[model samples]
Target: MKVYLAAVATGLLLIAESANAISVNVQAGRHFTHTSAAIGDNSAGLSFNGNWARSDHNGQLGSLGTAFSLPVGPLTASIGGKALYLSPKDGKNGEALAAGVGLSWTVMPSLALYGEVYGAPPRLTSGIDSYAEAAGGLRFTVFKPLTVDAGYRVMNMRGKEGNRDNKLADGFYIGAGLNF
Candidate 1:
């Protein structure tokens, strides 16, 4: 846990020092928390994220990713890939390279809706058969550089031996973000 936190902090610091635009986000649910930091403009950027959960079943997950976004009118489309690491308390640890697509639409000047999905096939994964995640939410900009959001996320992993299929996290979360 400490190592994860340190890694995220170091990544964020490096991004802050070199990027003109940066965003940091934090989300929390009943049994899990997610955090991410990114550097880049709306058109493209690199991001680092970490998730931690504590429950009857829990784990830690992290990813480093990059995205290219295209804006058309009031909507944006993005394509990205992430290098993921998962360590579950009761399952095998694994690593995957996943591809993802995302879309976001501006509902109003201060509100927007967004969703994304990521998946990895057996060929791109190790110590696991596959990995998948889906998430969506509404974001409300409270001010120029601050925003709040509510969202739901679900993540799954299939074990190599077909014995440790796990729902890493499946729940709703509320989060806040800072942009600069």
Candidate 2:
């Protein structure tokens, strides 16, 4: 996967040296319980969410995204896509791809709210099963360089079709971002 990402990123950089509107980051957090979609008799599975050492733990998640802004008379809109990858302590990692589009009213010079969604095609990694989160969230920027965001994401996969065999993942997420 690293090789694939490196190749694609390298290609993008080579062909698109003008892509200055981009942000790449890494995030780790205690994904709230709701993000796990705990069904009956499966509460124990979610208990280990924050336990990075456990298979279900949500450890360091990396995200890469690019945005392009277009001006239309009085309104300005930005459309972009992002990829999120999370490597669990239990040795399972899932990669998701999101093609998102949003509009900003630019009510203030430093503040704007945008809605976006992320989705994954399908993949397998390691022995632990995992799938993508077809999720949506809102992002609000403050001070122009920092942003706070919250959203819900869900993905369903058939056994062996995902990394964790046949288990499903569905849940809500809250996160933030910083831009340079």
Candidate 3:
């Protein structure tokens, strides 16, 4: 928790000096794993994507920071850290500051294919120390400001005192979002 706060504090400090734009995205999904039946794995969250106030040695904004935006040929590649607060059905809650990286390919004007990988270390989590996830999905621009998406994700978490990790969730989800 301290690490997450420190990271956010550092990011906010960096943002104070730059002229950047923020893009918001919200998502919700269902899970299939029963390893932790006490916590039904449904999840939802929102994120802010933006360029930081400073540029790296490579002249890329947030290139070496907690957030980054870089274009690789026809694909847009981005990486950032996200703090997540998850509420389970059984109430055995979990929180983690996870770092994620993703790539998107616009195969068509209104359609794109994307994939992302996210992981949270023990230092960033409470109770459970290690968490990891991977997802792939299709995104369709439904209107000028709205997009509809569907995807599948797999995630697992391990306790600090335990030798084995628990499979948390694996399922498909449908969602909609507005991008500005």
Model 2, position 83, has a per-residue lDDT of 55
User: What tens digits encode model 2's per-residue C-alpha lDDT throughout 54-171?
Assistant: 1244344445555565655434555555555555443455555555555545445554444434444445332334334344555566665566656554433222333333223345
| lDDT tens digits by residue: candidate 3, 1-180 | 999999999999777634332333444545342111111101112224421111111111111124455666667777767655533232245677788888888888799899989788878886566767787899899886687888886666554553345554466767666544
Error in Å for residue 178 of model 3? 1.3
How does each model score on TM-score? 0.82, 0.41, 0.58
User: What overall lDDT goes with each candidate model?
Assistant: 0.80, 0.42, 0.56
Give residue 125's error in model 3 in angstroms.
2.8
Which 10-residue window in model 2 sums to the lowest lDDT? 43-52
Of 1 and 3, the candidate ranking higher by TM-score: 1
For model 1, the superposed segments whose C-alpha errors exceed 4 Å read 1-19, 43-56
After the best TM-score superposition of candidate 2, give how far the Cα of residue 100 lies from its true spot, in angstroms: 2.9
What's the residue-level lDDT of 93 in candidate 2?
59
Estimate the TM-score for candidate 3: 0.58
Residue 36 miss distance in model 2 (angstroms): 22
Residue 39 in candidate 1, Cα distance off native in Å: 0.5
Error of 3 at 69 (Å): 1.6
Error (Å) of candidate 1 at residue 14 is 13
